[model samples]
Target: MTDDVRNIVLGVIAAGVSATLGWFTRSYLWRRRLRRKQAFFGLPENSECLLVVNRDPGTDGAVHRHDVFALLELSSIVKDCSAHVQILSHDVGRQGYGEHAEFCVGGPGSNRRTAAHLATLLPGVRINTDPEPGEDRAAFQLGSDRYRLETGVAEYVLLARLTGSQDSRPVFLFCGQRAIANQAATRYLARNHEKLARRHRTHSFVLLLKVVNSQAYGPDVVEVIGDVTRTAQTPPPAPDPETD
Candidate 1:
């Protein structure tokens, strides 16, 4: 073969090798970022994160069965992260959460800390308990979209993530009018976190999920009903400059 042709062939092969390596590097970095993002919720290795839940006084301070089941599933999900998990009730959560990432389980009526944090962080999304006449469930008013829990067949839950400032730690909220629905919400987050993270880049969003045949399958089946993050941005009560 002529020297000119040989040199051209070598150049082409080198360019192809370089392009292949660049693509692999980009793919690796993207996957790593996703793992880190998903790990922030008490899933990262050596992460010091808290898992907050509410206890029913009627049940003698015992965690509800649904909450317990959700916790178990969460444990498995983050097992690889080897997160240092600390379980606390909403009562103490107000003072307990520091700079560490956290998972708040249950709704406002049930978990006080979750209510207060969400109110301060996401004031636009209000959880309303006033059931419609002849109806048995509550609704969430986000911007113009009013998300209500379906009666009989489907129930709804709210899964929210929050980070106010650049230095602020992340907080994940799993809530519903009923304990079972809360379980379904957490399960939904665990199952579809990748899609949620991709769609909502703000790192803060609310998901309205519908539980399917929860009575039969528990929280195993869930569907995303709505994404209220954009609408839920009701200008978080002008942050107290003093606190800032």
Candidate 2:
């Protein structure tokens, strides 16, 4: 072949190699994250971890793409934490829609097992699947403390649950849009603080972090460790008397 043709062939080969190498690196990093998360949380095979990603209605495609990257980052964390993984999504009616990715370590009854594991990881934290009167599902509270956390299909809600409460915790909300994350955080605090206080009245604070696009929100977008406030109080009444 002529010199120019030979150089063109070499260039194409180099490009192909670079693309393959990039894909491999990404895959390796993702697996590492999954392992990290699993080990950090000590999630068993039956245990599952849920990640809620909030997105704007006008930019569903962008949100989805962003989550795909977030998932990879989360996967590395899960691997590091020694946990399993799954992916799900949620849409806030009239507001917007988002995605949810879950990591399951074990088999059937994983929810219960995962909850138990979480309790151990989150010391002094009261965990429950049921909601009290006017409470939301996917909610958990610190024992006798005002701190509460609620999870929806698309987002996670944190509340202080007391009078004059403010968001003091450095919480992170991973999403493609800042506005959507802020909105979700505001709604969660507005809707559930009172109810959370009734159940565990104490000094509590909630933080919201939104992950803007996967490229922007990297592996360190949401850290597992953070500060939280604790308080003592009586348990609130059940949401349904019949169920009790």
Candidate 3:
């Protein structure tokens, strides 16, 4: 073979090797990310997850449009992990709670299951279901810290993750003051799961998420107010023996 011909052949082989390596590298990184997400969510591949759908309280058992959007976001996350999502209503049977990987949405006023979880799992977290005239509908009171609704400007939600004894999988609670806030909380979860995993791995946690500019952004703008794990789980202040 001529010298030029041999050089040309070698160049083609080198290009093929480079392309193959690139493909393998991308595949490896994608798998690694998938594994991390699965671990963080306590969901294995092909696992089953329960989606408890919340309905509008005064309506004819119909879900709010914003709440439906929230569920769609959650469904995409589950599908990404190759998991199956089984949707159930907020009024599921007792066998539900902690029996499987779950995502329970809405506030105590709307979802009875969410109310039960707040009463049982995070006992200290208090939400006012009934309000006097001119009072906020769902005011969250944890010790001295109070979160009230401000309509379009700002809204609050408590996003929590906990594993139950009945099932090894985690239950994500998306408790919000309003339907738009629920969508915002789920959006934040989808965007920040990786960061959240790094912060708390396989451990239960609760965060206060604030939705800013909901009218303009439509749940796209969210910020983590703070971590309320301890306060939500227990009273903020208890008299120590020494103090007592």
Candidate 4:
């Protein structure tokens, strides 16, 4: 080949290589920054967090499969945060939640730990259940807005991110009026973690998510009702150990 032609070919190849490397580097850094933003709890390197699942009291400690599926999704994001995660049932989680960050799944009816904590901390939100057997009615009341099970009406899940002055570890509550709503809340968090983290970087926040057509679309149709973080008043005093 002529010297001029050879020189042109080498220059083209070097430019292509350089472009590829630049693209790769930018992509890598962008993903790294995203992962950092998704680290909601901000646990230090190798620290542990708890995933508390619910078990049906009517059954022999059998967990709902949908809830486990949601946990798996959350686990992946938690893993990316450089934290060790341990899964536990609500019964066990009731013992302690002081040192480690906690992710409590399921609503008050299914997870008593979630119930106790919600009752103690979040006064504005209440989970109500039917006392009569064979009733399929459940509701989550946040302030004056009530999301109850009714024909053609929407249901909701309450997703709360909280931190206490006494305890540095944050507590995440994922509670739905129904099982589908519970799963939807988790999926929503996973899908929008970066946006959520940026919005709620340090302060605590509460989200009310509406699950449209939950009977049909399940978690796929979930949407945010509102960001009630500012309205979520300071957590009430911890219950007395003897009374609790």
| lDDT, each prediction | 0.73, 0.36, 0.88, 0.76
Off by over 4 Å in 3: 165-167, 235-244
Q: Please provide TM-scores, in order, for all candidate models, with all chains considered together.
A: 0.73, 0.28, 0.91, 0.80
Off by over 4 Å in 4: 1-24, 95-98, 133-136, 151-153, 234-244
Instruction: Sort every candidate by TM-score, greatest first.
Output: 3, 4, 1, 2
Q: Report the C-alpha lDDT of model 2 over 42-107, residue by residue, as the tens digit.
A: 344445455434333345324434334444554564454445554543321122111212321210
Model 4: ten consecutive residues of lowest lDDT: 128-137
* lDDT for position 81 in model 1: 61
Residues 159-178, model 4: lDDT tens digits: 88887654477788888776
Cα error, candidate 3, residue 171 (Å):
0.5
Instruction: Choose 3 or 4, whichever is better by lDDT.
Output: 3
Please provide, for model 1 over 67-116, each residue's C-alpha lDDT reduced to its tens digit, 9 standing for 90 to 100: 88877766665564666778887887656343777788887767888778
Tell me the lDDT of model 1 at 141. Answer: 66
lDDT of 3 by residue, 1-244 (tens): 9999999999999999999999999999999999999988767899888899999976899999999999999999999999998898988635645556889999999998899889888988989888454465688898678888888878999999987663477889999988999999998899999999998987899999989978888888888899999888885465667753
Candidate with best lDDT: 3
Better of 2 and 3 by TM-score: 3
> lDDT ranking from best to worst?
3, 4, 1, 2
For model 2 the local lDDT of residue 213 reads 36
CA RMSD (A), model 4: 5.1
Question: Could you tell me how far off, in angstroms, the CA of residue 173 lies in candidate 2 after the best superposition?
Answer: 5.3
